[model samples]
Target: MSALLVAVLLVPALGAAVIALFPRGRDHAARVTGTIFAAVTLIPIAVLPFARDDGWTTYSATPTALRPWTEFDVSWVPALRLDFHLGVDGVSYPLVALTGLLTVLCCAYTIGKVPSGGQGRTLVALLLVLEAGILGTFLALDLILFFLFFEVVLLPMYAVIIGWGGDDRRRAARKFVLYTLFGSVLLLLGVITVAVNAGTGDLAQLTGGTGLSRSTQLAAFALFAVAFAVKAPLWPLHTWLPDAHTQAPTVGSVILAGVLLKMGTYGLIRIGVGVAPLGAEWAAPLLGILAVAAILAGSLICLRQTELKRLIAYSSVGHMGFVLLGIATLTATGLQAALLGNVAHGLITGLLFFLAGAIKDRAHTGELADLGGLRESAPRLAGLLGFAAIASLGLPGLAGFWGEAFAVVAAVERGGGLWLTLAVLAAIGGALTAAYFLRLLRKVTHGPTGSASVPAGIGGAEWFAWSPLAALTLAVGLAPTLVLAATSAPVRALTEALR
Candidate 1:
């Protein structure tokens, strides 16, 4: 099983090497090969839950520690006490699978259509590199290892944005790298603090604030809060995101909105709260306040945006804000909701970016003033856009509903002056979410046909790229237990420290 985990981690990087080394002008073959490699990573992810250590189920229903279903660990640097450790438990598995699925889809999408500035093969290789980094971040059980994987994503993504994005791509890419580098510096500091003070970087030993004094935990969490907050782009730190997402290529936007932001939220869950429980409890109120602020701020900003892609980019702030809110509650229910919101946002928002990009491509302009009556011209595209928008606003029986709704429920459950107020504000934010999306629908799909002429037909490649995201949004929404099932025990164990 450990070997299987190692192979899964290596496969995408291998795909990248193969694609990069492919013969000149073999872009088509290189893309196909990259997609195949990406698909290969998914098989092991699906099989992992069955490989759980004995009593994964029995442990909590029977009382278990944080036991991963699959893990591979080995000594790396004896001096640093850092091991090359990786594992998949309920908390991280959903994200790993999300990363693999989106990467493969993006790779396949590339085979049919390459963005203008870059070669298809090159884009495919970058996607594979991005995938490997995201997967490694989710799986790494060593704090330093986690930071390394997290950094791996920065450069390739910047390359994608600048190499293939719009005319202003350079500026957006620069803002992205500089802001994240600022966060990375803090993340490195936090990781070093934990490793030096605890005498180990192994997360298996550090979870629940174990092996550290209260002062150390508090200090570490403060550093982590800022680092992950920047990554999360929480509220004020979020200025760089809209530009990056708006200027990025179609497939790049999908992956960016899909799973990249989850890295920060995941870090908050796995590192900030898990490794520093006391600080998490102490800081919960402040986190909740900022989360609500993001929700309201993002919603209001989105209501005023003129471009399609930019609106979708701002929506991520509100969506991710919900995920952060769930994490702030620090209850099992809240953590489970956080995980669900994380995955659902990937599915629903990925679809939204896809539809947004589709609209921009056909209309030749993303300006809202230029696009109208999409339903009359391209009903399928408009319909899909409507479905994705509704799901994103937390419509019932859609993938986006459970996470946002449960986040509010979890906040209310936390039951204090601060939390209760946050719940009310978050709910109002949800209403504003509906207002902006409906306003979007009114502008794009319901208004009289605009000057821009969009084709009535949808392409095979578009359908191929989009169907799974649409189907999964409905599937996960209706049966959220699919996401929540594996998460129960691990979330419970993490929350135990708070209790």
Candidate 2:
């Protein structure tokens, strides 16, 4: 089990190295190597559930202390109180699995459609590095270790955007780096303050806001929240996202929506809330207010967006708004809703980006005015786009529905006039979500195909890349318990600590 966890982190780094060393122009070899490594990384995450002594079926009943799939801890830099520690509980398992799944699909997509002007080998190498960084962040248990893994993703993602993105790639890349670096700086300061004051950086030891003084916790939480909010891109700070998404390539956009965004939310739960409950309590109301604002603002922005990718990017602000709202409620159900929403958003938004990219590839533009009626020329493509749009709009019995509904329920259950008011506003945001998506559907798919040449349907590579997300979206929607169950235990533990 230990070896497997280590391999999960190392394999991708090794793959990246191999791809980097591969001869230039050997796109096929690079793609094959990346795919194999990405797929291999999934093995540990896949077997994690079964590897437990109590088995996968018993996960929901397992106690928090006993539920981690594996744990690896070792002394590293005794001076700084850092350890080479890593583990995965139910809360992180699904996200780690999602990362593996999306990385593999992205690699598969690259095999057939390398971005123009991108060196295939270099692109594959950067993706592999990015994958390793994401996986490491989810698995790391020490604050310093987590920070290292978290920052590791920065440069490679910048490369992906700058080297392979669209006309305004440089500007977008610079903006992305600047925003994230500002957050990273704050995050590092918070981590250092917590570690120095607590006398240790081990997350296991610091769970539930233990050890740190309330003042220190408050200070640390404030810093971490700013860092994560920027990443969660909670409004105002979110200006970087639409530009980044608009300029990035299809695969880049998929990973950005699917996995990268989760890093911020996950950190909020794991670090901000978990390690600083009193501070979380202090900030919850303000967080809830900002969340509602983001929900309304993102929806309003989407209604006005002419470009497909930018609209989806703005919608993320709204979707993540629900996640943040759930967290702000500081209740078990709310946190579980946040966790479930995290995974669902990853799957649904990733698929939306894929479809959008395919459209751009065919039509050479993402403008709604330029797209016209896709359904008339390509029923299959139109059907998939409509399906993703409806799912994203929180349609009943879909993956998106459970999270938003539960968030509103959580807010109401919190039982205050402020929460009730927020709940009503959030519900309105839901309706607005439906309006914008329906509007998008009407503009892009329902009308007659414009002058641009329309492809017959989505291609083989697209299907291969898209099928898992499509299946997961339906599977989770029909039986949300599958994911909710996995999250229940950890969320219960975290929320209990807050109380």
Candidate whose TM-score is highest: 1
Displacement of the residue 282 alpha carbon in candidate 1, Å: 0.9
Q: What stretches of model 1 exceed 4 Å from their correct place? A: 55-64
Per-residue lDDT value at 300 in model 1: 98
Task: Give per-residue CA lDDT, model 2, range 50-94, as digits (tens).
Answer: 665334333343222223567778888877667899888888888
State, as a TM-score between 0 and 1, how close model 1 is to the true structure.
0.98
Return the lDDT, model 1, position 233.
Answer: 74
Q: What overall lDDT, based on C-alpha atoms, would model 2 receive against the true structure?
A: 0.89
**lDDT of candidate 1 over 1-499, digit per residue (tens):** 7776787789999989998889878889998999999999888877877776554433343221457787889999877777899888889989988998898889888877888997899999999999999999999999999999999999999999999999899999999999999999999999999889988888877888878888888899989998888887788799999999989999999998888988999999999998989889889999999999999999999999999999999999998899889999998888999999999999998999988888888889998877999989999889999999999999999999999999999999999898999999999999999999999999899988888988887777788889999999999999999999978878888888777
How do the predictions measure up, each by TM-score?
A: 0.98, 0.97
In model 2, what are the clashing residue pairs, if there are any?
373-447, 373-448
